[model samples]
Target: MYTFKFIPRENIAQIIPFLQILDVNIPAETLEQRLNEMFDNNYKCVGAYHEDRLIGVSGLWILTKYYIGRHIEPDNVIIHPDYRSRNVGDQMVDWIHAYGKANGCVASELNCYTGNTRGQKFWSSQGYEIKAFHYRKMLDNEL
Candidate 1:
């Protein structure tokens, strides 16, 4: 049986390994700091657990944007590779939607990498529509 719960600050260390599986290039040392900063803002995270182990995670950013009005932006959704195709992702997404609605969000939004067709399909199946293109330019050196 899998249990879902809001992950707290002290327990964040337990999520590092699972997050690394989503983006292996992320520096483990810096991730905690960044996550802490985000948590201080409007960022929220939920985790799916099988007993004491984390098996899936999702993040949400509560924001008020001009175009979307007040909405919940879901990000960094990842399920353990071993647990794919078992509707775990769907359940996590469903939880996100319900959470957003309960919080009075007008809508839910997210961005997926253009090359991730599988992710795109999954989001589409969850009733998310493609509304805009997300472009990014790294500012690490310029800043």
Candidate 2:
């Protein structure tokens, strides 16, 4: 069994390892910079812990968009290899969904990498449906 907690901004460093698990090309310093920006905008992270060890984490953002109204966005969700196949992701999503409803969110939106078929299936299992393709354009590139 595992327990869950809201990892605070001050402890954001604890999420670096998990984020690396999601994307190793990004440098730690880069991830830290982005985390700082996201946190400033009220980003929150829910972590799944097993005996005081963080085994999984998912970042959440609650915001309003004219298209979707108020919604929550899940970003770079990852479960440690040793912890996958267990319900760590589910628990984190469950906690986040409940949080969104409590905070007035009406929907959830996220961008999963097109090549991450496993991740896509997991999201679909959780009732997420593909609405549109995510497009991106890099401005400066270097982080």
Candidate 3:
């Protein structure tokens, strides 16, 4: 089993180049801004590194209803293409689930593009159900 460590945003600069190699295209300035916001907002961000190279990232955000609330939620999950098929995604998700459980979340939600069959299958295999369906149409702004 490969060891996974949760690195903080302070070290995120070191991972940006690796994440870029994975085709993650967010600008460094944008990423820095986001990282600062996450830290200031008390959210948790984790990166999985192997031998000083970041191979995966999971961004988590806690959600609440104000009246009725959940303690934890995961916002994003991505594993480098080269690291796929080795169970890194599964392990990272499992870790996030455990974090939610520990924080008393009743449920966790993740949004994936409708046409991403691989993502749908993966989430299904991980025991997530299709609880809701949404349809949208662009009203305008086509150029």
The candidate maximizing TM-score is: 2
Q: After superposition, how far is residue 84 of candidate 3 from its true place, in Å?
A: 0.2
Q: Report every candidate's CA lDDT.
A: 0.84, 0.90, 0.72
Model 1, residue 52: displacement in angstroms?
A: 3.3
For 1-143, candidate 1 gives per-residue lDDT tens digits of: 67788899787787788778767788887788888998898778899877887888888888889988888887888889988898888888778878888988999899998988999999999999998999889979531
Predictions: Cα RMSD each: 1.8, 1.2, 4.0
Worst 10 residues of 1 by lDDT: 134-143
When sorted by lDDT, best at the front, the candidate numbers are 2, 1, 3
Sort the candidates on TM-score, descending order: 2, 1, 3
Screening candidate 1 with a backbone cut-off below 3 angstroms (N, C-alpha, C), the clashing residue pairs are none
TM-score quality measure for candidate 1: 0.91
Model 3: worst 10 consecutive residues (lDDT sum): 15-24
- What lDDT score is found at residue 141 in candidate 3? 55
Across 1-143, the per-residue lDDT of candidate 3 in tens digits comes to 54566667677675555445434567777666767887788766677666766778766887876643785555556777889888988888888888788878877777766877887898898988887775678797531
TM-score (all chains, Cα) for each model = 0.91, 0.94, 0.75
lDDT of 2 by residue, 1-143 (tens): 88878899999899999999877899999999999998998888888899999898989888899999999998889999998998888988888888899999999999999999999999999999999999878888673
Clashing pairs in 3: none
Query: What lDDT score goes with residue 136 in model 2?
Result: 78
